[model samples]
Target: MAELQDELTATAEMGELAELSSPTEEPPAPPAPPAGDALTRARALLTTHPVADGYCGLPATLRTLPWYDLELGDSSVDTDIPRLRDGGVSALLWTLRLLPGTAHAENPVTAVLEQLDLAKHVVAEYPEGLRLARSASEACDARAYGRIAVLMGPAPAAAIGDSLATLRALHTLGLRVLTLSGASWATEAGLTRFGEEVVREMNRLGVLADLTGASARTARRVLAVTKAPVILTHSGAHALNSHPDNVPDDLLVDLAAAGGVCLVPCSAERTGSALGDVADHLDHVRRVAGPESVGLCGAYDTGAVHPDGLADVSRYPYLIAELVERGWPESDLAQLTWGNVQRVLRETEFAARAAALRRPPSTARIERLDT
Candidate 1:
């Protein structure tokens, strides 16, 4: 655990923060706030608003999947709930995937269905602590009642198979977000025609299409066709890290122009540093594509190596403090944390509801396909 703290604190030149204690340490404490008079107010302001990790995971959800194999201990079931509550995280987009090449990879559609069932089961087991959020209003309500709103998303293009109706059915079953493809799907190129159809279906169904794992071509194609705002739920800027998973400056500008948000993640795979690196990615996205275009998608508890100060879900305040100390305005911080994501959700859901009302009653048909 001390080794993890050392890795998190090994910043480039931003000095270091106090060591973050392991989750099992006595009292299960949150990270200490950076020294300053304004930090107290920053922490207060953070708790005042409904804080949302645009993309995160709970220990229970990850533990159910053997592939993760995380040694979360008792914290997996008991302690992490309080950790999130104490950290002021009211809502999160919980990702559930059955990636290709895995044991459950036979039928992508069946895999997604089973995974969705598992997600519901986990949420049901924790009735008081968690609730499924289908719309932005539901997420805010979860915040008002002091419960964590768990919005579910399926990753990559394979999950939907070859049918558009399958996409609609998943949304009907409470899947709110969709990823057209990830980095691995990059080899399957020339998807302009089919990709456009999928994006349109997502708009009609009111699902937010996430482009985190998409190739540049796929991302650009979807952006060109999507009428509603899209979200790069967990990615970084290519200008900063040059990873294929990261979005380039051209796509970043395109994303902002189309009323989308590029949510920056704190994982080492995305950003090579900790809190300071996160701030840099956030600032770069804002600078390249305005403040409204950036947001947070820290994939907590998904088995990714988190940077130092942000080693767990309970350390969100430290990230907020780092941004505040860097002179981010309160309004910008609000947008980064929750406002932008809420706006996208509300708009997307509203459009979906409206489309459903205008459609003919007989149009709802399940197109049969062999998956």
Candidate 2:
């Protein structure tokens, strides 16, 4: 910890503090939406499939948009989904819109529900997103948001001004989990004593607490207070990936011990799409928390698309191949792919209710998919 602090302090004091994007430093404009053969090639690779008859339809919260961000060129998204899918991922734990902040989120849930035909994931929500969820089915029919899971995060209990009202709104909108904060910062809900009271309230209302993107201090404090299993949605075990965004392996195990599930998000923030990086987090979690505790909270940006390294979701399968080569057990693979996340979601009241709801295309839940 001291080492990291020193590194940061030295960097800051050296007058190397970060600068806002000057006109030139700005994200290079997206190359003309990948036209002609390039567009065709990209589409061919990222093709999505609809659910087959008898196959359970994706939960409303798990859909992703048709556009993949990596194609646009982003640095933070990971290549794990393509790689992990190679052998077979158990289930998709989508925390779409990513979680840099309310402002930094990308790929809205509605986008996924309407497009992104390949796979599905759960979503994290922002204030605007919450409002959108209220009528995603209707909006999409008009060719708007695709809509998916609300990786619903509660401002740390410390943060929520009107807990009862906020949760009531979330429940009305069908939000399942609330992570409490975005990455790195602490919220009021994550505050010391008062936070616990909020957790109690969330638990009563059936909201799971998400601990990912939480300050390390917040992690230490929040876990001590909450009663329900917390989720570190879309995160990596730090021991291996070693990024600030990742939870340390020891901490991940502690989260599991506290009965929380740690979601290994497949983004560049941690392993940068190295098959080894993906495997390392999964392995660490499995070794410590056992199978029941870990799952993927994928935050891939097939839209903005990273550089050559972790790039597109087309590369998702590569991770699976690496796991297989290492002789990973098939059962374990199942857990990572879908089993773990499924268990987590299903156990939640929201999933159970959603499962009972109509999935038939003509059924009410299926509004005309937004264009």
Candidate 3:
């Protein structure tokens, strides 16, 4: 019995020595909590690469409520200073007029000028929140200053009334985008002779031709004639929605080849009322037109209902988070949100400079050219 007890004591001592010789190990790290969720990653990504929204109809809405204080946030509107900041939107191209064919103003030019004035006044009133950006560099500068860059225009081309000089005047008044609209320009036969001249002058002036509601023929003609990249500021993939305003795949390919961007809108009429529906359109655009050719626009304050997850400006990160969940790389998302639009604006400026050196301002009149 004593021998057995001695043996047991020896065994206990051996076990103690083995325990002392063994290295202690930490418990598994609980999987590190995934580093962050998709939404967190999306917000972080947007900090470096903020969204350059292609369209916002705040100006048009402001025209009606001239006294509306944007600083105090408006529940009636989808856009406001607080919401814009929350959205991580660094830049916006504010439409200065109603959609084409909808404005029944006796003088469309005068109406557009009124909207432009209102937009400038609003920007000036909220200097801390907004900065008027005339170029891509200016927009980036605004972002650096922690301000939202507001770019105005693409008022109906008809607003200029077939006068290239009027177009120049509008540019002088801060018109960076000129909508190619009206019955004569966007028909099946394509741009009239005057329309081509207007596009040429726009190229020389550094104005982007906005093909928001243009027909395929007009889009093709502009692609063929303009030396600068164009933008479909608020559109979707027709293949997905079949809306007349949605761009078809063939045009998207042509637009991509021309170094243009198709800014996908969150309009439920075109993309449905679901967040996945908007993402689907975005994916379709990216697939058909390539990554560099896709962009985002909330189309807020435009009298159109937005998708479920993207009902207002503040929901942009949610869309980005959805894309992140779909395995989109950071680089591609960067281009989609910011880089592509900035590149388009930069290229448009470059094309204008080159065009200016080659030709004088066009004096071509609609009466003389079209008739």
Best by lDDT: 3
Stretches of candidate 3 above 4 Å error? 1-36, 99-104
lDDT of 1: 0.74
Per-prediction TM-score to the true structure, in the order listed:
0.80, 0.53, 0.91
Going through the candidates in order, what is the number of backbone clashes in each?
2, 63, 1
Report the lDDT tens digits of candidate 2 across residue range 83-114. 32331222233332333343323433433223
Best-first order by lDDT: 3, 1, 2
Task: State residue 106's C-alpha deviation in candidate 1, in Å.
Answer: 3.5
How does each model score on lDDT?
A: 0.74, 0.46, 0.89
Range of the 10 consecutive residues with the lowest summed lDDT in candidate 3: 97-106
The residue-level lDDT of candidate 3 at 65 comes to 66
Model 1 spans > 4 angstroms off: 1-34, 59-73, 76-79, 99-101, 182-190, 357-371
Candidate 1, 1-371: lDDT as tens digits: 99877776676223422234445446667888656746576678778764678766553355464543122333543225666775677888877665446766667677778778877876777778888888999998988887888888745567776566677788889988887774232334734455666667787788898887787777787777767889988888889998777989988899989889988987887887677888899889999999998988777766667888887777777888787888988898888888998999988887777766765322222232111
Question: What is model 2's C-alpha RMSD?
Answer: 23.4
